[model samples]
Target: MVRWQVNLTVLWLGQFLVMGGMTMIVPFLPLYLQELGMKDPHEVATWAGLIFAGNFVTSFLFQPIWGGLADRYGRKVMLLRSGFGMAIVMTLMGFAGNAWQLLILRMVNGTISGYAPAAVALMSTNTPKEKMGFAMGTLQSGAVAGTILGPFIGGLLAEWIGYRYIFYITGILLFAASVLTLLLVKEKFNVKEASAKPKISVIQAFGQLRHVRQLPSLYGVTLLIQFAMLSTMPLMPLFVAELHGQTAGLAFFAGLVGSITGFSNMFASPILGKLSDRIGPERILGICLAGAAVLFIPQAFVHNVWQLFAARFGLGIFMGGLLPTVNALIRKYTPEGMESRSYSFNTSALSLGNMLGPVVGGAISGYFNIREIFILSTILLFINSLWVYKTLLVRKTSIEVNFEDERPR
Candidate 1:
């Protein structure tokens, strides 16, 4: 295979391992807290929430710093740094004596977590521009597939090998991914050229608006896409329970409902990505956003779990198109020499969305019906679609016309 294709394949695997290992322990956090001697159920719940969100909070703050460094040095070194750092932190979590230790370790894990973003930066610079959507989409599929399977595998492994051992296994997997990247992934970063370029301070990294006009808006798009999709996730089990009634198979059905979107997403992302490559990422993004917004409305009205399942499946097909297209556009608009910084800032936006979506969803569910969250997501996504069309598509058309007018004839 050619070099970019090779980079994509290896990085896809690395992303899979990173995301899967990270997510594996998420479902079992409360249980793990209990094992750590937190007997009070309320205490366990609070600790679990703190431990889980701790990672994203630090990750959101630190990603841009890492991105700046990645541009100054190289994305491959940053990838290895996150991979190895996380592996060590995850391994130590297996030995944490108390909830506080675990929480601190989790926060550290988040602080060092940039493997996926670094992978994206490396791939973005290396891949051909025309194939960028496919690269982003295919890479996203790895993470989605990992997210879908990680919880299930973690649940089973928790049952069989126990919870602490799960951490050990996760550490091993992360180490393996880093080793693979160290040996295989080829990044043609020019050391002399990168050293000669002006250093990107954290402020300079985020202060990219002066350089790239579409960047801040694109960051907003990334944040909103993540926020809209994840906002409904926390309420899913309760919603499933309400729909399915108090049945013994309720957990099974809820798991299915939670994961079915990923099934379709894993398949749809690459397909939509290729379509975007042929047509234009801007238009594909708007089409997918509108479609997802419409799908969310039906989900709010679904009377049964099966109907919700179908709605989520359809929503997945559209959701698959959103991020890859956004990444493609980010690449198209980003200044040269700042590719890593741009993608890293986008990662920070994504981390913010991941942190806030559940909190907002929970608050809305508390004040209103769980179904209202879907309506809220629908409205937000629809607004985002309109914004994309006005900012990206219309702007593209005007620029093209202006270019044609200026061309020598």
Candidate 2:
């Protein structure tokens, strides 16, 4: 147990270092574009949307491919590949001379950035069943902490040096993280001969949908929960800009707000995971989802910058528990030999939600007001939560029977 804990901790640290380095570029990318001669706010906004969207688009598209390869080739190799690949691309991004150059690099970075998912697959494979929730939660908290710190560090670095220097620094940190992973992580590829064959196609990886009848309640709840969780993501920076402006200081403030929210999640995740273990993950998820919806609605009404900040911070507390609980619930349903494939589908679903959230939010904000975007997001989340309550929690018996039959009975 101690050895496994140590290994998991080291893996968690590696994930933290990588995430911290990678996220540093996010807060400064728009500012970097403006400096590169795209001076129009609309263009900057469009490019920013593209930059954010590009990562998810590629990451979402390629996740199952990477997951299948990891299952066959080995997760440790994939981890190394992700870390080194990202380091190389990120370093090259510092040399980008034009907006198109930077955009291209971002797209490449997105295509190759699978370190988090790799680490997730590794940790999930190694950890014992009873402690899976705790282990996954702890790992997620590390990521949340890194996400929180990245912007603060990047903002300061961008101010002191330049946005280009921020990229260089991130690249260096990522390279260092890769080195750490190579030195510490020991791979024990547990592939059975029967399962090693190419039975699962990349398309079938997304075909967890076909098994909806197998675990209808769990699947439905998970989809709704993810949708509710991601609905507010795109509106965040826009909200910050409305309260502040497009200045570097405002950008830093926006980053700070984002970081603080993520930082709060760092503390809240493990506690929520433990609570889920004691009570029930579904119940905890229901509470958190509803709380996040209620908390987020008030952001639309916040009159001042401080009020907006407070609302986001409060929202973070409820939202923090979401990812770990979702992962735990998914783990509950995953069969023993298919952990990698199950996680791939799970992450793909999350990526799908992420892809839709920003596009929808951006369109709504463009068409109406930013505040109206929040209102729309809030209403959608509320409806999603209510749907989960009706469909899943209300039909517990049917779910139990399905689970019983799916097991080797």
Candidate 3:
């Protein structure tokens, strides 16, 4: 097997464990908050949101720094740094004495976590261009699988061993992932290539945006895609409750309803990703964008839980294509050896959208209704489709070095 094949396999497993361990906390967050001394329901709810948001805020801030370091030192180093750092932080979070300590630790976890994107960088640099889509798609499936399974497993474990032990277990899983990466992952980083270029400062990194083709709008699409996907997340359970009018199995149904998209997405991402490699990522992105836009509209009009679930599952099929294709495009356009920074910037843009999506979803749902959130996201995605057409499809990029030629035929 080629080096990239081995690397992809290791990275895939690492991403699965990291994402699974991280998201496992979501199922028990409110309960954990209560255990941390938050008594009132309102207070617990607010703190839970705050703790979740805190992680994203810091992650958004710190990703590029780690990415830049990956370019200079090695992507594998960044992977291990993120994985082990998060393990330590997560373990500490299990022992928090108060909400403040937990909040701070969550922020720390966000600040340190970058293993997924770091893995992406490593894969992007190592994989043959002809197989880039398949690698990214397969990697995306790992993350989606983790997201799909994490909460269910966590919920079961939380019941069996309690929330605090779940945190410890999560920490252990992350540590194991880091160790796997250390033992199995390989990097072909040349130190001189990074040092040969003028040392670019963080502010200078923003200036180097010119290195990417369609910089503004590519990043814009990244932000828009993430925003559209997450816009309904914060209110999903509430929407499910309203749909069924306070049913006894509301919690189970709500969780299932929310996860259906991920379920479909988990399967669809790799398939669409491989397809994108054949037809061009731009075309794949355009198709998925239009499909998602149309699918989201049905979500607003759903009269029953099953209808809503169907709409979300359909949306997931399209949603699965968006990020992997976009990243593939980003890889195609980015300057050689700067893949880490570019992916990091993309991650930061997506993370920003994540932080804002829930806020926008909350505002729209608060003012008009949960249904309106779907409507607004539909409009945004439609506009985004037009943007994708103009920026990615119509415009001819300057840096068109075909990577397939670099690969051994």
TM per candidate comes to: 0.98, 0.84, 0.94
- Please identify model 2 stretches exceeding 4 Å from their true place: 34-44, 192-195, 212-255, 303-306, 390-409
Candidate 3 per-residue C-alpha lDDT over 254-329 given as tens digits, one digit per residue, 9 for 90 to 100: 9888789898888898899999889888899899999999998988888888899899899889989988887888
> lDDT scores for all predictions?
0.89, 0.73, 0.87
The candidate that wins on lDDT is 1
* Model 2 C-alpha lDDT per residue in residues 327-360, reported as the tens digit of each score: 7766666655455656666666666777776566
RMSD of 3: 3.5
Which stretch of 10 consecutive residues in model 1 shows the poorest summed lDDT? 204-213
- The predicted structure with the larger TM-score, 2 or 3, is 3
TM-score of structure candidate 3: 0.94
**Model 3 off-target regions past 4 Å?**
210-213, 396-409
Please give the clash total of every predicted structure, in order.
Answer: 0, 0, 0
Residue 22, model 1: lDDT of: 92
Off by over 4 Å in 1: none
Kindly list the per-residue Cα lDDT of model 1 for residues 82-153, writing each as its tens digit: 999999999999999999999899899989999988998899899998899999999999999888999999
If the candidates were sorted by their lDDT against the true structure, best first, what order would they fall in? 1, 3, 2
